[model samples]
Target: MEETSKLQAEAKPMIYPSNGKAKEALINEKQPEVRPVRGSALRQVLVAFVANIGTINTGMVFGFSAVAIPQMQMPNSTLPIDEDQASWIASLSSISTPIGCLLSGWMMDALGRRVALLLVEVPLLVGWLLIATAHNLPLLYAGRLFVGFGSGLVGAPARVYTAEATQPHLRGMLSALASLGVSFGVLLMYALGAALPSWRHGAGVSAAVPLVALVLAAVAAPETPSWLIAHGRPKEARCSLARLRGDVCDIDGELDQLTRGTSISAGDGKSRSDMAASKRQTEKPEPLIKTLFKKSSLWPLGILVAYFVIYQFSGVNAVTFYAVEVIRAAGIGGGDSDYLTAVAMGVVRLAATAAACILMRRMGRRPLTLISSIGCGVTMLGLAGSLAYLEPGDFSILSWLPIVCIFGFTITSTLGYLVVPWVMIGEVYPARVRGTLGGLTTCAAHLSVFAVVKTFPYLQHLLTRPGAFCFYGCVSLLGSIFFATLLPETKGRTLQEIEDYFTGVTPTLGPPKENKKKIKSKELNGSVPV
Candidate 1:
């Protein structure tokens, strides 16, 4: 009885707004009513599928370079590419990716989530259409560049939209769709590359993919409730949440949390800090540029950027993009049979990524990531040793070694390295800065792709193919150590909870009466916070 009396005495009203209008809205306005779905997974699936469509388009475009490079170098090619041109063709996508990423953040925030995704579809369609009809290298390069732009654009939106739209239970698997879509797209392109008469024919047919994504996104998908609320449309946020939940009651709790934590350091009185510290942190709005430079913000960015750097530098791109060459160098098939090997590798990647979707929810992010990095490191090193130590011509018995190594790299890399970085990128940041950081991370990812792809030939020349694999193995092993030590466990927490962790706030707290009374007294004193 005394505890209840003390708790009531200690309770204090917190004024969340800095201005009169917001204060009036919170105090006087009633929440809009809406219905929600109970135990229905449809809304989650639809949003994920819509976001996945953009990723699929991105994947197809990315995979386009891998298969089309071979055809462009063939004799009688309409736009035959030289060694230098082929390298550029492979690397050009990386060059244009950051531009796309920049646009993605703008479109997502300025226009809308749906609008940003629609923008992704248009460039992919046009890029492929141009590729199909192009008679010269310039047109071909331009088309490839456009496809890359579309791909880069999808990266930011996919992470932001999926994270915003789905519940915490589904976040890991759904967000993983971003990476999975890319894997499937690569698989799709490989399938088409094998079955079609030519690369041009395959690309021409693949243009239909984004066209479908465009229609579905325009007609069916809804903007996320979180995005709507952040943009100051609470009524719309309610409506979207209702549709997303579909007959579930009491959705207001989540809606309220979403509204409160819209910024990076949402300094409501519930935080672990003292009332003075809370007031000081939220007193003045931090500028975006200033926020980017702060140690707290920069630390997460560093982790995300390094994750992607490790993902690309683990030699995944070098192995996948130059699969045929690697196999040939290792004395697999004499001529073009390595194309078949590339296709098989794509299937393996798709399957492994799909498996990761299920396993991530059960086992959590950190464990799977550690396993993937270490496993890939070991496989790449084995490939290196076999190539460096054995004579290709004399060791006919070990011709299968390269195939085994490539398959091993594909399976191990996809299990964690290919998928987990995107998942972490989605989960680790505050919503206020998610779009900006996402763009920066995407830029880092593509830049690394360019770096590894452009330099692989040189590295192979300097250290031989075996030594190149050895170097990549070293990178993978080092990355594994970082993953084990640095990454946080975010398997089942809500977005608001994750954001609080970054802000040094605990998800759960119990305030002592003395501390609560002290805070209440501070607020009642009415001094302007610094």
Candidate 2:
């Protein structure tokens, strides 16, 4: 402890970056040593905010079909879409999203996370513009495809950026903010869908969000320190770290730890630089396929892929893409009230996601997900039961059951299943192949979404609404078992620590290990604190 204090007392203020370049400063030995201060949580939040702004546009893309499909199906509509075309319009984005995820994975590795985010504006703007002016089926299909591709591109980078940039204490909340942005965007679209005269106007207005995201990414956000260090730009990493941490804290220790990588321990024979040099000299670069097949990659990949399958088939995309139809099937409201209820659901989701940001830090991941999954199962089963057994005139008295169930499911799912997986996608993977694995997981996710959303209409026809609800409910309960048995708690752990767990090495240079018992407890039985 005394030696730790001495080290802390000897620390110096970090040099902040300016105009994308870090200004270097020499330390004066005669000057008094400065102790490290806590990092600025405010700057962390700002960077998180900027990184995730594009998610709002993502929300708009998903919700657009909800409004547009109903509008296009109306009598005397110009671009009349039958059920098949409408399903294509909604599901095409999922098909194209995997392409975007692959591109994002490669770009995040090659160009950097910030650059990947900035480049996404091109697809988003073009897609929204196409949707705004589209006059025919093919044009509309093309527009939705473009928007889905852009939406896919935005997700991984934003989550990865927040995870890498912020301190661990703030990581969960900041990372969860990405989902908050998506919820707000969905709400914004729902409002626009109700208030605007046409879906075209809504699509036109939605383009403005990506433009703002571009400006924020270009002007306000810095490249993540992890990316800079991985690319051998240690100086730039230090600068970016300094800026994110603000002038109050000494970043030298953190910077050195980052440079050393996660493998360093007390008895390590060689430094990280020596290891890198030896590997470069002795071996060929490992093929991407080999990397993908590694235990570290496959373990997390399997969990995420299965979780995403649960998330999509649990009726999330079905609710999101076809909210009006689902609500109508619930038989509570008529006409404009259904849109009003959709907006209300959006508001609930946004608020619940905000609560999740707080709860994530307080309640941890495992418990909230368990609670959420169980709640989803209960609510969905309740909805199905009510739909199945209730007499037609009985709706007059128990009229609130369907809508209540819908809202309950929305709240429950948003709290954990919808939001936490996105956070895990950013946190659980090893940094060496984070971009590739993240994209694959995201690709898997969207593919599941495509399958679920595209087949939902058919499922409703074949199984009927009650049967469909029963299917989703059963899936949610079964998924809770996965959460219980397989999922690891990531709350309060640094991204590096989480990665270390998957790699099966004790993290010697990461966050404090006082919480080892907590992590162990979480893993053993998936228990949460009271």
Candidate 3:
């Protein structure tokens, strides 16, 4: 036991990159560490954000169901579908997302981030075209399947790209852009669906989004330097870093950190022959089942799994997939009122996500999530009460109340729970297994999403709408408490700092002093203060 303890205490951090020669050159101590300018680093983030348009295409695809379903069921429409088909349409994206995640992991590792993302656009573009031209149900289903595959695949590379490409300080805010892009995509369709004469009439428009993404990804985006280094292309890695560094030709400290895992102090000059004998000896990664149990890996995987459970059960999918049904059930008839309300909610979610840029920076992640979870619980309970107590006739007079509560929930969820988990997913893991772990967690989360979306009608049938909401409310309330007790603050810190927190190492960068004091004081008060 003492020997085990001593061994643990004496352990050294592993090197991250696979380039044998670069590893030796990377540790050269004669070089001075260049502190990358915050202003310059912020600009590098723009490339990742532009490529994130692919993520927006995902939201557009899901939003298509919201608008297309009713049109597909129209009496005079060319391809009206039954309730079963509509349900299948809504749930298929979730079904294929997991499969896409698994395959995307391999593609990301094999093809590189930029090329893998470009590959993602191929199916999404073709799928939209198939959707645009389809006259029969099979073609429509096949198109949806392809789009689902792309959506599922996009998450890992998008995450890996943003996480690897951005400076550690800008990581959280930039990562939030993925979800923000998703909201924008959803909002575009929400507005477009309401404006277009018919869903089928959206020709030459819907496919434009992914095509733009494809073009931008190919022309504007840079390959991640870390991926380049891992593949033994240090010259390309150096070039990628120089580009990301903005007007700088020399690779900075961040590049060394990437290649070596931990930051290394400069070593004295060594003979070129000494460096020549170096060879990379990275161990083969374990299988996914065994990978799940590592101390560093387990926290992120377990928490994300729980987060998805709480997230999906928050009724986001149900609310989005059946916004019209929800309003109609609340005694408002399906028509202009329902679509307008959904657009309003979509706007709310988008606006809140935009605001999250500031909130996450100001309040930090744990606080935002706690606030979001608790507020979601409260709003959901209010929705349940509104449904249970309000008379059908009285809905005309007080019809706006439920919308207000939903807006409130949107404010809360988007501020924290909706986007932060994803940000952490990008931030929390070691780069060695990041792709594999990313795929697995995303797949699991989407599977939960599928289960929740498919069961919405059944859940409503079993508990009634009000009862279903009450269940979500109670679950959210519990989720808030769980976060309060356990979720670590991740905002404003580097990925290394967050990993250190999970691994029980002293965090290299702690929160600002005022923020730390505020967090502790809030915890002492028995609430996770936001």
TM-score of each: 0.84, 0.86, 0.83
- Candidate 3 lDDT tens digits, 1-530: 99998776665333433577666676764465443233265556778787678888777876778878877787888998888888888888788889988888778777888888788887788888888888998888888888888888887788778888887557777888888988887888777778888775553377787788888888878898888977778888877877776744235555665665542211233322113212212445456556556777887778877887887888877777776677677665457777787788789889999898667667788888888888999999998988898877784656667766777877887788778887777877756567777888788878987888888878888999999988888989989877887677766556655565565454333643434655455334432101
Alpha-carbon error at 276 in model 2, in Å? 14
Best by lDDT: 2
Q: Score candidate 2 by TM-score against the native.
A: 0.86
Error of 3 at 15 (Å): 43
Backbone clashes in model 1: 7
Higher-TM-score candidate of 1 and 3: 1
lDDT (Cα, tens digit) per residue for candidate 1, span 279-311:
544666577677667655676788878888997
How well is each residue in 61-168 modelled by candidate 2, as lDDT tens digits?
Answer: 878888888888999788888899899988999899999988899899889999998998789999999999999878888988899999889989998899988876
In order, candidate lDDTs are 0.76, 0.83, 0.74
Please give the lDDT score for candidate 3: 0.74
* Number of the top TM-score candidate: 2
Q: Per-residue error at 495 for model 3, in Å?
A: 2.4
Sort the candidates on TM-score, descending order.
Answer: 2, 1, 3
